[model samples]
Target: MYLPPHFKIDELAAIHAAMQGSRLATLVTATTDGLIGTPLPLILDPREGDYGTLYGHVARPNPQWKLPPTGEAMAIFTGPDAYVTPSWYATKAEHGKVVPTWNYLAVHAYGAVEFFEDADRLLDVVTRLTDLHERSRAEAWQVSDAPADFIRAQLRGIVGLKMPITRLDAKKKMSQNRKAEDRAGVIAGLGASDDPVDREVAAMIPME
Candidate 1:
């Protein structure tokens, strides 16, 4: 990933926060056949390593796990994004030099990949994933809610994934390159837009 100094996210805490906040991630790996990408939810164990470890799973029928990865695997996490029209930039009114751009946050984690199918590990992974997503609910559901035999059968249909993240690349491109007036215009324009995501992007922009 390209890292311009102005947009780079180097702080470990910030990088971890971005990854955790973006629940769904794109898992990519290269193989003898070609590049494969799967979008799924991944949980981070920040205590696993100097960086952290990633946990997730793929369907048993998914070909991605069948082939051996030629190199390192990557997990891509993305945060709120919004479209910025030229009309939102003050420079457009000044000299018609501005163009449309996007404001967003992203983090890429790379490491060795391992696949497993052990029932116990799968059960643990499934239970933890369920808990993570359901924690916000007033009446959170648990793996125990389902019949034991049924849950075991369900776990058999998927393969577990473990990746000890060796490195991370994070970036927050939130109109930081724009002039103050242009950024203010962008904020006001996005904040007033009909899309809730646009308003989210507005809140992410740095004012200082």
Candidate 2:
């Protein structure tokens, strides 16, 4: 995360929000065999430890969980992102000096990774994760909706993981470096875009 002062997100609440809002995260680890990465959904427990803790599960056969991480593992979370055209910069018309860039939000969490196979812990993690995502649906689903034997059988095919976060790096590159006029132009251009995500990035930019 190469964070310039203007782009760094220092607030813990903001960082956690970005992490929680991300639907998927990439978990990366360095092992004797080299680097391995797994894409999964992770739940952040802000109440645990100093920074927080991450909980998720991986398929039992996934080699990522079997490998011993040499040091700390990292989970990468990314939020709304969009490409910014130089044409959106008001300064581009004045001096023709501006180049295209990107606007986005990202967070990197580092901690010692712990993989477990305990059925009870796996059940708890899966239940909480299910509830978090399902709560928004008009007809929510639950772990208990399935038969106990089926749920227990399903849990056997995966392993649970937890990482007590030791470090967090968050960045929000939302054109904070641009002049007010240039930023306003960007907002207008993005707001006119057909992509809803482009409009989302537009709204995140600060005028000041």
Candidate 3:
């Protein structure tokens, strides 16, 4: 994460918000063979430790879990993102110096990963993850809804993951580097975009 001073997000609470707002995260680890990445959902327990601990799981047969990690693992959480066109910048008309760029928010967490197969821990992680994703549904489902035997059988196919985050790096590039007029133009352009993500990024841009 090459973070310029203007684009850096140094506040812990803001970083946590970006991390929590993201549902899917990319877990990357270095290995003797090469680098491996897995797309998965993680639950952050901020109270678990100094920085925080992440809880998730991978399929038992997934080679990522079985492969030994060479060093630290990085979990990447990406929030709202959109493409900013040069047409959206006031500078384009001033001197034709504007170009397209991406505006986005992201958080990276680094830590040592612990993989476990304990039934109790696996059940807890699965249950919590399920609840988090299902809470917005009209008919929220729970692990208890399934038969014990079936749930147990399913749990056998997965391994739990726990990473106590040692450090966090967060960045939000929302036209903060541009002039106020250019930023306002970007907001208007993005707010009128066809993509919902563009509108989301527009909403996140500071107006001042």
Candidate 4:
């Protein structure tokens, strides 16, 4: 996450919000074999630590859990992103100095990785995760909706993960480095585009 000062996201609340908005995260860890990564949807426990705690799980048969991680793990959360064409910038016509760039938001959380298999803890974590995602659905679902035996059996096929986050690297590269006129052109261009993600990126860009 090579974030310049203008794009850095240092506020804890803002970073947490970005993570929550983008619920899915990629967990990356280094092992004797090589770097292993898994994309998982994580729930944050904001009260757990100075930074926060991440809760998620991976398939029981996944090799990532079997190998011991030699160093810290990283969880990456990505928000809306859009492609900015040089044609969208005012500078392109004036001096032809602008180039294409992407506007997006992302957060990287680093911490010690902990894997667990305790039935009680796994059940709790799974249930909470389910609730977090299902809360927004029109027809929300719950863990208990299934037969207890079936749910318990399903849980057996996975391993739980808990990482107490120690460091956060967040960036919102939303054309903040561009001049006011260039930024305005970018916003207007994206806002008019058909891609939903582009519109989202436009909404994130600060007024300049």
Candidate 5:
């Protein structure tokens, strides 16, 4: 994460919020075989460590969990993002020097990874993960809604992961480097875009 001072996210609350909002994340590790990555959903336990802890699972067939990481593993979480056209910058008309860029939020968490197969811990991780995502649905679902034997069998096919975060790097590249008027122009352009995600990114840009 190459974070310029203007775009760095220093607040822990903001960093955690961005991580929690991301539905999917990429977990990457370096092993003797080389680098391996998996995309998965993770739940954060903010109270678990100095930074936090992440919980998730991988399919039993996935080899990522079986490999021993060389050092720390990294999890990448991404938030709303939108492509910014130079045409949206007010300065483009003045000097024709502006270039296109992207506006987005991202967080990288590093920790010593732990893979576990204990049924009890796996059950707890899945239950909490399920509840986290299902809570917002009108008709929420629960692990208990399924038959006990079925749920137990399902858990057997996956391996649970725990990572107590040792480092966190967060960035919010939301047109903060642009001039005030240029940023306003970007906001106006993005707010009028057909993509709802563009509008979401527009709203995140600070007016100042």
Candidate 6:
């Protein structure tokens, strides 16, 4: 994350919000073989530690859980992102120096990777993750909705993950580096875009 000073997101609340809203994350670890990465949905538990811990599980057969990570692992969470065209910048007309860029938010969490297969811990992680994602639905599903035997059987196929985040690097690049007129132009252009993500990105751009 090569973030310039103007593009950095220092607010912990803002970073946490982005992390919580992201369902999928990329987990990276350095191993003797090389850098191994896994894309999965992680559950963030702020109560677990100072910076919060990530919880998830990988298929029991997935080699990532079996790898020996030499140091801390990294979990990446990406938020709303959109392509910004040069035509959207007021500077393009003023100085013809504008270029395309991306407006997005992301968080990188680093910590020791811990793997476990205990039934109790696995159940706890799965139940909490399910509840977190299902709470907003009208007919929310639950682990209890299925038979205990079936759920137990399913749990056996996966191993749990617990990463206590030791470092957090967050970035929110929303035209903060551009001039006010250029930023306003970008917002207007993005707000009218065909992609819903562009509209969301437009709304996130801070008013200068």
Clashing pairs in 4: none
lDDT per residue as tens, model 6, 1-208 = 8878898878877777899989899999998889989999999888888889899999999899898998899999999999989998877888898789988999999999999999999999999989998999999999999999999999999999999999899999999988888899989999998989899999999887
Clashing pairs in 3: none
**Tens digits of lDDT, candidate 4, 1-208:** 8989999999999999999999689999999999999999999999999999999999999999999999999999999998999898888999998789988999999999999999889999999998998899999899899999998899899999999999999999999999888999999999999999999899899876
Across 1-208, the per-residue lDDT of candidate 2 in tens digits comes to 8989999999988999999999999999999999999999999999999899999999999999999999999999999999999998989989999899999999999999999999999999999999999999999999999999999999999999999999999999999999999999999999999999999999999998
> Once superposed on the true structure, which residue ranges of model 5 sit more than 4 Å away at CA?
none
Candidate 6 TM-score to native: 0.97
Error of 1 at 204 (Å): 0.4
Candidate 4 residue spans exceeding 4 A from truth: none
lDDT of 1 by residue, 124-196 (tens): 9999999999999999999999999999999989999999999999999999999998999999999999999
* Runs in model 3 lying further than 4 Å from the true structure: none
RMSD over all Cα atoms, model 5: 0.6
Model 6 per-residue lDDT at 35: 94
Model 4 Cα displacement at 6 (Å)?
A: 0.4
The prediction achieving the highest lDDT against the true structure is 2
> In angstroms, how far off is 26's CA in candidate 1?
1.1
C-alpha local distance difference test of each model: 0.95, 0.97, 0.94, 0.94, 0.96, 0.92
TM-score of each prediction: 0.98, 0.99, 0.98, 0.98, 0.99, 0.97
Q: Flag regions of model 6 displaced more than 4 Å.
A: none
Q: Please, what are the lDDT tens digits per residue for candidate 5 over residues 27-135?
A: 9999999999999999999999899899999999999998999999999999999999999888888999988899999999999999999999999999999999999
Weakest 10 consecutive residues of candidate 2 by summed lDDT: 84-93
TM-score of 5: 0.99
